[model samples]
Target: MSESARTHTRQRDDASGATTPAVPGTASFDRLGLPDGILRVLREQGVTVPFPIQAAALPHALAGRDVLGRGRTGSGKTLAFGLGMLARTAGRRAQPKEPLTLVLVPTRELAQQVGEALTPYAEALRLRLATVVGGVSVGRQAAVLRDGAEVVVATPGRLHDLVERRSCRLGRVRIVVLDEADQMCDMGFLPQVTEILDQVRPDGQRMLFSATLDHDVDQLVRDYLRDPAVHSVDPSSGAVSAVDHHVLVVHGPDRYAVTTEIAARDGRVVLFLDTKHGVDQLTRHLRAAGVAAAALHSGKSQPQRTRTLAQFKEGQVTALVATNVAARGLHVDDLDLVVNVDPATDPKDYLHRAGRTARAGRSGTVVTLVLSGQRRETSQVLADAGVTPKVAKVRSGEAELTRITGAKAPSGNPLDGGPVAPRPKNHNAPFRGLGSTKAAQGGSAGRPSRRTTEARKLAEAQRAARVRRGG
Candidate 1:
């Protein structure tokens, strides 16, 4: 963790978790006091050494001390807090509708990711962990809660709905975690996140591996976390020096050509667009040009979004065209390139989008195609992010663009319509966006799941039946 580790463990009582005297830590997970079962699981997964954030936070977390841990994306934040929560909830028989541990994330992708990361450990400890996110069947999530689950990983908005329906209870939750606290707040989940936290046990241990511990997340720390043991592994912004940051100046008329060329490059790459409309437009163009592109945004159903990601990861889709939804919590293997087709308006968005690459100590490049009118603003955003990128004026099919991003011309022929999954005919109608307001509730990016419509109708029917039965 040498190159990746710029960490310091501290303890503070103030609202702003700042520097203070050092908190002692160990280098190994076993030495940090993780249970044997968890250590064995880690070993089985070939995870031997602890990341800096994990080393700094696990000691406090395992001891039930509230922890505020901050690290760059892909820095083992899940393991930092998840192991302790699982250990604390182990051997406990949760009553139906009441979980012993709660993990609240900002997105459906993140909830699923955290669940997948923690599953083996929970299984080793004999704990049942449920991931509750919108986009799929609400009845399935409700049934899991209705039966029994020791741990629940969720997105706030859907969790609120479940609570209102009385299908889940937070009263028994003694360990609460907010995975991306800053993103949760930025996405306006603060009220619901706070509401959910308030419902958990008063003395519950809280931990976070946040994107930023600056302004947006301060309220969460002041209100929920007790005089916590805090760890800041990276700088507040989480920008890495190893990443190749580039700002490519492109003329508006040449933008589409440049984008298509990059998408047609020989390797897999993620192309970021600001809006769902733009993402779809570019994806369709790429497919027509035989680029094997897929679109991902909040306007797609959960299953559609899930399938898109699977295709991207499995190499079935060569180009991933997306919006801010995939900016956070989406991890792909060997993904060495990310092209910001539409420059990010905010520094955090830029950082998160750039984070999709350069993960796990690998070399990656972030290229932002800036319009002529966008240079000044994009420069300011980069300055705010503390990154000095390699700036160059690039045009479509130019050698400079090719050198920087491996850009090349696409095939004249169109793909056979297998790159991006075809929209479901019988399920959700082709939503220009993603889910129903009710089923797609929360800060989740895509809005398109017919599964949500069916689930909502089922819930309403169940309630109507309950009213008739007087149960």
Candidate 2:
């Protein structure tokens, strides 16, 4: 397809996704200029309206101009670039072991997500899409590519591994997209990205999308992009407006119970914990509670990660308990809730975690479980991040929780029938000061010495102190 024709295809859809028909002076998809076939596909998929990112990047991305997009995760990035990739590669014939379009992402989960998002649109035009990542066997990906997939979405490490092993080639790649470029830098994947980019055709189209473009990302753009068009739809300054954030403070003993209650009645919940062990433990507990949950962490094997993600997306698992693994690259639709079991140490981490919800302007909730000790630290983080959440104590089985979550309480007490333990008065006794040691010696050990000395004094002065004074 011609570049001009491709650009027009993505820009044609500007309608809001609402079901209500457009009135006079109302925004419509016709304003953006998408093709009727693509529009039909979107409508069938219940995507009638355009998200801000999609509206902002579609036009330039489709035009085959190297576009730099600045938007948060779940801000319709996949569709934005997916439309661009589909529009550009529509008429191109698939070649064996060579892809016409390539999408580079940070993590395996994201690669699969992007592939899934674009698959339906690619299928409309009979374009093939293959996922290449490290966890699964590369042989399967090689076979799929050999069968002639037009597009390839892959993680940087896995994709580079494939290239080094001579399992894949990028000489025919026409469109190259680096989604979540900032995240790649954070994960130390720049070398892999640089290696992968060196192999792709230099004269081909390149589009880079990220939440924020820092020095490292700028370096990639300067070296890779050719007079790239920049589009900043919600830059760092603009990220907060798109997300709704809240912090819920609870007692230390009631943390897990509170988290379980919040996650139980969610739409799609990406529950983030501080550590991998937490992820595994939370997954087990949630599953036992009849709330289907899948654990995603670095400890899992590749196939396990892939399967867990599949179940999560398919709604077989209502909650996905994860560490930082799902923080950066994941883009899920209609994520109704984001429960941070442990509040993020910094505001940046908080923003990344909160970004999972409130994506695509669909309006979602972000509830963070802050135990007693975490209140001050988490409060500082949120304040620095410029987020203000309604602070309230969560009563485990109270009416407020019921109002917030429509689901009823589980049969028995969710706290494992343990009584709340009061904090010890001498909390610092284990590391007590010298005064405490001296007092202990004087009170017990010193008493015996004083009594023995006083016994001899009493015998010597038997009747010497018999006088009494009257006032």
Candidate 3:
């Protein structure tokens, strides 16, 4: 066979026997056996065209068959499963504490995203939806469940906690979808996943979607899914054609400076580190260097994380510093740049971090910084992931950095002539002062800083104005 023919043959052979090929040309939601309400919702969302994964998986899923879908991030896997689950349980009424459909995700962020994505469709169908995740009020979640939520999107840990507390039950679940199954396994949620699956109705339909079907995922498939129609739309590595990858070799001491320059660039940028502490420290360093940046990690409360993400998305913060927790299934639109401040420990992590950009056919650039001590390991990681990026030995404020990442030197002044304060552990506490805890407690030599004095004067003026107007 010719090379092209051989590639086609492999693509045709990747799926299981029960799989059906997707038709070429743009496919519409109406042609895919979806109901009128869902079709209307899709139109309202301006989704007139369906992506490859949705086209391949929707047919079997809508036909009430088990489906194992494999697709990269940002490939419309959420809609692929979400639409099917909603269509299957459209007319069903959920009893208190027992949902008709359950969508399991790997992280709190993903749960929130998926719920937001599906809410309009559920509302159009007159279906009540609830999101259950940890790091928030369980009482609120239980109240929603008690009031009867037909569709529940949740993270496994919080769902399991609710199940154990008898606040939520799985006995009436008619359809279950596991989105991002590979990530759930990576986060050590397989046992909890299996436990939760065991409680669902035995005859319910199941759909599992993942970027890759490794050994652990295969085991879950064997144990839970029955005669599933498998579909693989894109490669698991998430190396989209629109993204350009580069490796920058830098000196140890210059690493932070290079990263700061990149983050200070014009467009929105997401910089990834290996640890939560690294994320916090880098965020502080970037803010101190006059870049508007925010940190997101597991240690942050749910509300703080949400606020940080909103800030980044709304352009209030130009760069977001995060750990691997932000990698999978977190979508931010129009993000053109991603930087790996610390080289990912493995290829999978690298790909997930890079997937944050170049999404949905938008052009993006991903740059990895490698110091002398990490060159060999970084090279091996890239090779294993089948990515061959251009390597350059660069320094801070060099032409190479500018040419590759559009990084320019930043003005030394802080963004607003004020420091970014460290995130408080208690979400209810007000931010007392900028950047310094000691200053917040008491200024140096018992004298307030100029900014604090100005803030007090402004507050007093506002209060006096309000009092005079009222009394």
The model with the greatest TM-score is 1
Off by over 4 Å in 2: 1-36, 237-243, 266-268, 313-315, 328-333, 401-408, 412-471
lDDT of 3 by residue, 74-128 (tens): 7788998899889888888999999999999999999999999999889888999
Among all windows of ten consecutive residues in candidate 1, which has the lowest summed lDDT? 423-432
User: Which tens-of-lDDT digit does each residue in 225-257 have in candidate 1?
Assistant: 888887888785555555899999876556667
TM-score of each: 0.86, 0.76, 0.84
Model 3 CA lDDT for position 190 = 92
Which lDDT tens digits does candidate 2 get at residues 37-73? Answer: 6777888988866666676677667677776776666
True lDDT of residue 274, candidate 3: 80
Q: What clash pairs does model 2 have?
A: 7-62, 11-32, 12-32, 12-33, 12-34, 14-29, 15-29, 16-49, 17-49
Position 185, candidate 1: lDDT:
86
Q: State which candidate has the highest lDDT.
A: 1
Model 3 misplaced regions, further than 4 Å: 1-26, 415-471
Distance from true location, Cα of 139 in model 2, Å: 0.8
Better of 1 and 3 by lDDT: 1
